[model samples]
Target: MDDQDILMVSEAQIAESFDADGLMLKPLTLFIKTEHPDVIERELSVLGFFSISTSTTPEKTPMYEFTLSPLNT
Candidate 1:
């Protein structure tokens, strides 16, 4: 994937997408749950999250990144 194709989305958005489409229609780049750690543990495990911390702002409010697993069945 190229830099232009990258999209960062939260877990809620991921769920919404999955629910609306019944599956992931497009490839997801980084899956994030924001400052919510509990959601990360339960929601992102199936995607095989890499669980990396990122600083989205200058104050660096800790953001979480989940590396998605292959969706192909």
Candidate 2:
């Protein structure tokens, strides 16, 4: 791994790695566009990470704070 190199991985790579087992990705905080936080939880679970906790936000806004686990190597 290169030092100080953090790649914003494409969704394709994330999915491929899910099946193919490529280099690992660090945990991420994705700000999903939605009023509902549950969707982020579900999506992250599908993406192979557990949701730690969500920050408080107004229901009308689409941005949700989701902390997920590191990607599986």
Candidate 3:
């Protein structure tokens, strides 16, 4: 099949979330949980907030990009 005939589906880009001073998401989550378990619980209670607040479309299943390799004669 020609290159144009190949079909590919890819995942949406995930953004890096940070605190006001630029603390990374993981670190921030850990820090918050350590000091305030309630905060983490509250955050989790509001499901889908991360993607929703960031305007990201949730991925139900993993998607991949399809590549076409040329057949050798």
lDDT for model 3, on a 0 to 1 scale? 0.28
Off by over 4 Å in 3: 1-33, 48-73
How do the residues 1-73 of candidate 3 rate in per-residue lDDT, one tens digit apiece?
Answer: 1222222333221123344563334311211112333444455446533321111124432222212211221
Candidate 1 has a TM-score of: 0.33
> Lowest-lDDT window of 10 residues in candidate 2?
1-10
How well does each candidate superpose onto the true structure, as a TM-score? Answer: 0.33, 0.42, 0.21
State which candidate, 1 or 2, has the greater lDDT. Answer: 2
* Tens digit per residue, CA lDDT, model 2, 1-73: 2223122335864564344554445544545555556655766577655435566446564556665555442
How much is 23 displaced in model 1, in angstroms? Answer: 8.0
The root-mean-square deviation over C-alpha atoms between each candidate and the true structure, in angstroms, is 10.5, 11.3, 20.3
TM-score of candidate 3 relative to the true fold: 0.21
List the pairs of residues colliding in candidate 1.
none
Q: Locate the minimum summed-lDDT window of 10 residues in model 3.
A: 64-73
Worst 10 residues of 1 by lDDT: 49-58
